[model samples]
Target: MKNIFDKKITNEIIKRIDTLTPETQANWGKMSVSQMFAHCCVTYEMIYTEKHPKPNGFVKMMLKLFVKNKVVSESSYPKNGRTAPQFIISDEREFGTEKKRLVDYIIKTQELGEQYFDGKESHSFGKLSSTEWNNSFYKHLDHHLTQFGV
Candidate 1:
């Protein structure tokens, strides 16, 4: 997996993001480009903001057990995989707004870098090593960006 903390990789990712436009259509899946941007933002929001609720004990355990490895591993996600309820964006979104927000979030994460995330406690999955954090962050962005053919 590419390192999110690496400025070069992050810049490349941003370059891909810049290639998107309001009219960009997904090569696969159901999301519009703006919805995909918002969906990607959800991961960063879970990390940097308190807006989303943390899961309950049982839910957290389930996420940790069944979903953690898939999320944090350096593996590509299967196309059209199921997503968490919180990640669903059914309403319309402003393309410019979501695009800027996603870019800002990416820049913020890159500035914070890996050491800050090493052994950091995630909202649902407890503490993660830097590699796990990088895998989770980079893989998701890569998956969606590729999905949109960026």
Candidate 2:
């Protein structure tokens, strides 16, 4: 897996994002380009903002037990795979606004670097290593960016 904390890789991801436009069509899935951007932002939102409510004790335990590996591992997500409820962006979004937010989040994460995130408490999965954080961030963005054929 590529290290998202690396400047070069981060720039590459940003470049891929720059290619997206409002009318960009998904290669698969039901999300519009704008919705995809907003959906992608949910990951960072969970980390950097208190926008989404944290899962309760049982749900958190379930997520850590059953979902953590699938998320933090290097494996690419299956196309149109199930999205967590917090990540579902059913309503429309402004393409530029969402895209900028995603890009800003990526830049901020990269800027903070791995050390800042080492042993950080994740919103759902409790504490994780820097590697787990990188994998989760990069993999999700890559999946959705690829979905839009970027």
Candidate 3:
């Protein structure tokens, strides 16, 4: 998996994000480009803000048991995978606002670097290693950006 803390990879990812606009349509999923951007931002929002509640112990246990591997592994996500309730963006979002939020999150994450996240607690999976964090961040962004043919 690519290191999300690396500047070069983050720049490339940002470049991919720059390719999107309000009119961009998904090649597969139902979300508009702006909704997709908002959806992508939800992960970072969970990480850096208190917007979403942390999963309860039972849900955390279930996530670690069943969802952690797929999320934090190097493997790519399957197309049309089910989204968590917190990640479903139903209302329309301004494209510029969502994109800027996402880019800022990426920059903040990269600035913090891998060591800063080495043993950080995740909302659903408890503490994760830096590499696991990188996989989850990079892979999810890649999946959604690619979904829009960016």
Relative to the true structure, candidate 2 reaches a TM of 0.98
Instruction: Please write out the lDDT profile of model 1 over residues 11-61, one tens digit for every residue.
Output: 999999999988988989999999999999999999999989999999999
Candidate 2 residue-wise lDDT, 87-106, digit = tens: 99999999889988989999
Model 2 misplaced regions, further than 4 Å: none
* lDDT head-to-head 1 vs 3, winner: 1
What's the lDDT of the predicted structure labeled candidate 3? 0.93
Where does candidate 3 stray beyond 4 Å?
none
* All candidates: TM-score: 0.98, 0.98, 0.98
Residue pairs in collision within model 1: none
lDDT of 3 by residue, 1-150 (tens): 888899999999999999887888899989998898899899999998999998889999999999999999999999999989999999999989989999999999999999999999999999999999999999999999999998
Instruction: Return the clash pairs for model 2, or none.
Output: none
- For candidate 1, the TM-score is 0.98
Query: Which 10-residue span in candidate 1 carries the lowest summed lDDT?
Result: 18-27
